[model samples]
Target: MRKTITRIMIPVVLACVFLAGCGTLAPNYTRSAPPVPVSWPEGPAYPATALPAASPVLSEMAWRDFFSDEKLKALIGLALENNRDLRVAALNIERARAQYRIQRAELFPSVGASGEGSVSRLSESLSPAGKGETIDQYGVGVGLSSYELDFFGRVRSLKGRALEEFFATEEARRSAQITLVSEVARGYLVLAADRERLALARQTLTSHQATHDLTRRRFDVGVASALEVRQAQTSVDSTRVDIARYTGLVAEDENALSFLAGTSLRAELLPDAPVNSVTLLDEIPAGVPSEVLQRRPDILAAEHRLKGANANIGAARAAFFPRIALTASAGFASDDLLDLFGSGTGTWAFAPRIDIPIFTAGSLRARLKTSKIDREISLARYEGAIQSAFREVADALAQRGTVNDQLTAQQSLVEAAADSYRLSEARFSKGIDSFLNVLDSQRSLYGAQQNLISIRLFRLNNLVTLYRVLGGGAV
Candidate 1:
């Protein structure tokens, strides 16, 4: 028993010691240079931004601080807790971690204990003693069957690949969270803007309704013409149509917000103020392209996947060499049941195997080629992710640089339209100008008010999108 134990234990101990300290054949990973310019583009559309040199990156900031509105923050918090896409992403991380552990286990031997018994009838002619006999054999042993010796680091490389994949999964969850927050913010803003539009529609409806009633009274007394009364009625009818449209739009916005929040939202959590009341950070600086590549979760996830592909290439390269394994067992052997554990019953075994690929019909080469191609593909994807991120930042910056100018111009247009409506009404009341001028001015004013609401909505949504593309996320 002692000799058998030594035979089995010595090699197992040595394999474990060597395998634990071994390194993989995978090529060292080095990130390629970014595919975009080092600095943001210079143009009229690109905003010139000034920020403190020590200003934190968006990813490092807590999301609560990024948004100034309590209602939006509450809604975002609920979505983070209940979102299904995020739940799936979290589960994927767990699965990848388990897979990595399974791959890591390949670096060790699996030992097991077993007992066996065999009974056979020997024919007289076949027996060595030339007599019929019934034979019984019994043994108990500890054994390992075909345990691989990862001398070439193939197993370690596979483990490394699994680990990188796990990291990629984690980053993917982060990216999903960032996107969800942005979507929710934008949805809330849309709901708020729609509510404002509905309010404006109601105001116009009441104003035009009052004017239509006054004109009808005047026409009954033969003071206002029939055409003037019809014109007033037209304005009131058009506003009623707008009121219906905006009311429907408000309901749809709430529905979209509910979906984004992952549950039915309480009335208290819904937008109750105009979009202009919600505030975000000042337009962020487009510091450089590196900020996006280093901070964005989607880009980071792509980078991890690229590193994993590189690890896969190392494993594929290791497969071309011979595979070495060990099969060993130690036990007691006896034919007589009474002498099964008697003296001199100890037994041992050891088998070392080497499988050199003599011929594989090019399967090995094909796998190697496939792995290399996968690496190239991962590289392209990583770079593509970087490019996409840069473009998003650029697009957001373009709007950031010019949004204020557009808002100012729209405001001026509203003031002018409002003044024209007031003067045209006064002229119609004084019997100087036709009532058509009053109708035209009222329509212009309503259109300008609606457009102002749209511009405010655009500004708020752009801010949220900027935060997302810049890697600002709380969860």
Candidate 2:
């Protein structure tokens, strides 16, 4: 009899394995392509310089290759290692991976081993033979208990949800990393620009101070009026105030950079001067907006979440179907522990269960509806992410085209202002012009120089922004 049972069970178990390969009931997953221009907008909004025919793949370029500054490269490395947000993002990926594994495990049966011993005393009144008796039983077994038969793909759907979530988290981590790199570079550029501005302020203050002293001496000799001296003093005092303001700004910039770095940064790693030149691989073939936006980590993460939502809909739908579960065991049993594994002491049991939903007061229907709604919500979010990314890239490109022209025009303005200031100063000293003319030229030159520095910083920082928006960092 035992041999006959074993033969029957072998095929049953094998059948279960073979039939478990049924296809999932989940809705087919199809990516919704974002609606965007085939290429970056041409014409005035996009500068001609911003459009490249073909260039190195932006996503594959290493951050090191994109940022040529040694100090900036070191700062970005430090931030990637120590930033708390990035660490959290990375840890989330691991957690999601573990969750995915746990859900996937539900698709398979878990077999385990067990050993048991039991003793019972029976009273005379309750004994079948009308005599008191003590009985002992020992058993060893291997079995699978209450394992679901996923004929409707419920488990598969859940596993798919877990998988998509895992992918989403991984992409989120990548997004965090890209943002961190951009932030570090921006902070460093601000610090450099502030330093240069601070230097310019000090130089202006010194020149104005000398002019004020010379005017005071000329006034004492009755060769210059008190008005001229006061004008010179006003310029000196205003420049002194600018110097103090810039000093504070430079300090604040350093603090911001350190916070992003996740640790106290060495002075050597800080930019000593304002960023006059930014070395970056700014030229990239602005492929169709869809192609570029698809590579963005945030956009990818959103799409994964959308996929997960679709999987959840499958799980909810499967809930409306019947569920089947199986429990089985084969073991050795005997009244004495010594005989538990002896010949002819074998035992076996099989149980199968089915649960068909009779009534749920509309719970199943409501759940299915909720899952579908969630999927729609995810779809909207995915589309929104693509739109946001498209806008960012467009804005960056718009700035990229005109920045060089702005820089060039600013340099020319500065040169013209400097010449005007020099001529006015000479004329005032020679008694051919009022001190007011010198003051006006001085103001103009000072403003022009400040504007020049600002434009230069913008150009450098814009390159960083463009790189980030294009998803150019990290291979």
Candidate 3:
């Protein structure tokens, strides 16, 4: 039985190996270049920065190195591990890999073994002997069912398509990881800004309360007017209102941060440094080539899909040819169970079936056309992804170029407001100016400080944005 099986299987294995080398009808794959300019845009918004000969590869830099704050780094780490979106992306890669394996298996035979036994009794004139007779039979065999021989590379093309799709899924996971890192950093910055605002509000409230107390003492001595004392009380009440608003804002920020962390966070992971104090990431070196966008996982994923589409076209073309399947088995069989494996009981059978497409009413042509169209669509999508990435980088550059100026001017305004507030207070004490001047200066100073925090937040966020648009070095 063993020799008989080997005799039947040798030819089948050789045929599979030989025909698999027969090239696929799918057009030779050539990577398409991005439909974008070779260099980044330059103008007032995008300042030209020269690239050094040893410019570090941005894609190779780790996120930890990009973000300087240890606390923010820790938060990003937690998010990468626990974020639901990232986890889903990872699971999708596993599923795609399984699908690829399944497709690849089609290139070989599906071998199996089986055993059978039967007992029957016959009694009738229809029987050769007009009397009753009993019969028993048993058999065992090892064989392979129908397995397609890829003479035209139909199965191979399908396997190639599955492999490319698997690669695309892996890139998708990388893209998701990049997005998660950027989001966590942005959330941390937002929380810090709110906390700083809350602190500022509290300080303002205390100062207003002290001024109100001094005005009341002056009124008790019949030296200050009732109008001035009322105005002073108004300042205190207004500051208290601001304090309440900022206190709620801080709590909301904490909730958002916790949600991003994907679990209840300890106080240590929360932002402690003010928005300006935490250096999120170093400025991305200028003159980064447009080729860098190709490294972005999203763009790479799109290109993989395009390659898969190209494979699909080959599979469709192969469908126009005949499909040959081999189903063969070799074993031993006998009328008696005891003789099932005896020397004289060897048995074998081989069947090769061919399917020819005679009249499909243009369905084959339609399928081929559809596959070609799919390839074109994938190509367009790939190009579109490149254009989108270019636009994002340009936008980031535009905002980054101007943010420092805004921040610098805001700081100067804050300093001037503080001096004016101090002078107004001295003049009010000496009766050279009314309390309204001091109140105006205090409001201006508080507003200027708030604006400064916002600008700092924008500058930090711009850095984070540039990192993300450049693929975050998360690749």
Error of 3 at 61 (Å): 1.1
Which residue pairs clash in candidate 3?
Answer: none
Quote the RMSD, in angstroms, for model 3: 4.9
The stretch of ten residues in a row with the least summed lDDT in candidate 3 is 280-289
- For model 3 the local lDDT of residue 181 reads 87
Model 2, position 79, has a per-residue lDDT of: 95
Q: Is candidate 1 or candidate 2 better by TM-score?
A: 2
Instruction: Give the runs in model 2 whose Cα sits over 4 Å from its true position.
Output: 1-22, 49-54, 118-135
> For candidate 2, lDDT tens digit of each residue in 1-475?
9999789767766655665676676789888767666667666657653335456667878989888888899999999989999999999999999999999998889999999999999999999999999999899999999999997789999999999999999999998898899999999988988999999999998888888998999999999998888889999999999999999999999999989999999999988755696565556555668668878888889999999999998889888877779999999999998878799999999998767798999999999999999999999989888888888888888887888889899999999999999999999889999989988998999999999988988888888887777776674
| CA shift of 129, model 2, Å | 6.9
State the lDDT at 284 in candidate 2: 53
Alpha-carbon shift of residue 177 in model 1 (angstroms)? 0.4
Q: In model 1, which runs have C-alpha deviations exceeding 4 angstroms?
A: 1-22, 116-138, 283-285, 333-342
Model 3: per-residue lDDT, tens digit, 67-159? 989899888888887888888999999999999999999998999888999999887765798887888888888888889988878999999
